[model samples]
Target: MDARTQWDAGRSEEWADVTPDAARRLLTAAVQAFAERGYHATTTRDIAGRAGMSPAALYIHYRTKEELLYRISGIGHRLALGIVSRARDGGGDPAGRLSAAVQDFVRWHAEHHTTARVVQYELGALGEEHHAEIVALRRETDAAVRSIVEDGVAAGEFDVPDVRGTTRAVLSLCIDVARWFREDGKHTPGEVGELYADLALRMVGYAHK
Candidate 1:
């Protein structure tokens, strides 16, 4: 099957009987297994064991490891896109939208560190066909940010010479925060989000004064 078909098929699994709390446990276990054992090495049994469910029970929810991985990855991409969409719909100027986007990006990654880690590190572990779907989602995210930067430059709200490069820099800055941010770290998620928003604004040549 093609990537979109594969993703759609995977998402069609029935979670109607699964309570919100149980669903969270399942996703949490999936993320931990993917992160600890790597996607290629993780199995449904591994996740089941981690979540204290039987292998048969796990199968009832997820037929394969790839499906679980796709679900986790898909959620991360959707979360990022949702944040950007909300910012754009907020009817703000370029700088306000950019600041909102940056804040949302940082906060999401900080709160969902394991999900972010699995999304970033285990993408290659997806089946070749499934990898394409994930890549497409990622590209859409890149394009959204690039378009934002281009709009900012055109509107004279920012002075970036390279929209693509600036977009990559801004995204990388947010994505990498998951690698080092800790709940007990010197900065809380809100603090880190504001700091990164400031840095991203400066990078795009927005005057913060």
Candidate 2:
């Protein structure tokens, strides 16, 4: 399949760092299966089959289904956190940085909606320890956005009354794109990102012009 098809089908190169071709294949297959059937419903055998491997091969790569979920969650969440953190640290004024953060964050979710769906929605299926780790990463992501809002407020560039709530609301708006975005949708990922960025700026009471 073409790269686009692979990505839309959840076989994205987002996990290209995963070692060994077989392991990457399994990771890709696991993402596809989990995104489609959910972590609780998807089986190791199913993932193995999708990767064109025997079930035993799955064991060699990943100890259990939850391990696959943990791997996926860790990678995806870190990627998301990096996106927001870069915008937070990037050289820009508060409004500019906030807009960049929301725009890029939303674009990633829309473009990688399939992977994002599994990453954002399948956390509950992770083991307790794994869940905690993911939660910590999520908190960092929240902090990244909150820091931008705080900066905006401090700079008098935004009129947010509740920085924490507004930060979450912004994240929620961007993250939800994964649940609903489609390649064939009226808006391309970039368009959705631009639109959401504008809305986010408005939410902060910034007169982005």
Candidate 3:
């Protein structure tokens, strides 16, 4: 069987028997283990232990470590894309939309640091076919950001000379925050969001009103 087909077959079982809260806890533990130990080093037993569940219990939810990692990484990208999509759909001036998008991205990364870290650092551990699926999702995210920037530039709200490069810079800046931001840091997540929104606006030449 092909890799994609094999993956689909493996994931075809219904997990409706698992409670939403239990699944969330499992995903949380998986994210922490994947971030701290990396995909290759993280074992299902480690995630199960951290989540206070037995390995068999975890297996009832997820078939393997790879499946857990795949789900986390895939969800991270989807969440980011959803934020941008919603911001665009809100119907505002270019600057307002851009500010909202940046804030949303920053806040999401701060709130889901473990998932962000795994998505950023451990994606390579996915099998090649699964990696391609995630790569496409990431590309869609990049495209969405670029489209926002391009729209702003065309609308005369932003003065960036290179929309693509600016999009990458903005994304990188927000994604890296998951690496260093601490709950007890000098600035709260809201403060970080505001700061990043300001910086992103300035990068695109949108002066604060």
lDDT per residue for candidate 3 within 66-133, as digits (tens), equals 99988888877887888888877678887888788889888777766666788888888888888999
Descending-lDDT candidate ranking: 2, 3, 1
User: Largest TM-score belongs to which candidate?
Assistant: 2
The C-alpha lDDT values of all candidates are: 0.78, 0.90, 0.80
Alpha-carbon lDDT of model 2: 0.90
Q: Candidate 1, residues 25-96: lDDT per residue as tens digits? A: 677788888877788787788888888888888777777888888888877787787787777667667888
Q: What is the TM-score of candidate 2?
A: 0.94
Candidate 2: worst-modelled 10 consecutive residues by lDDT: 2-11
Cα lDDT of model 2 by residue, 1-209, tens digit: 64356445543558878999999999989988988888888889999999999999899989999999899899999999999999999978998999999998998898888889999998888899999999999999999999999999999889998889999999999999999988777887778888998999999999557
The list of candidate 2 runs beyond 4 A from truth reads: 1-11
Q: What is the model-wide C-alpha lDDT for candidate 3? A: 0.80
Model 2 residue 34 distance off true place after TM-score fit, in angstroms: 0.9
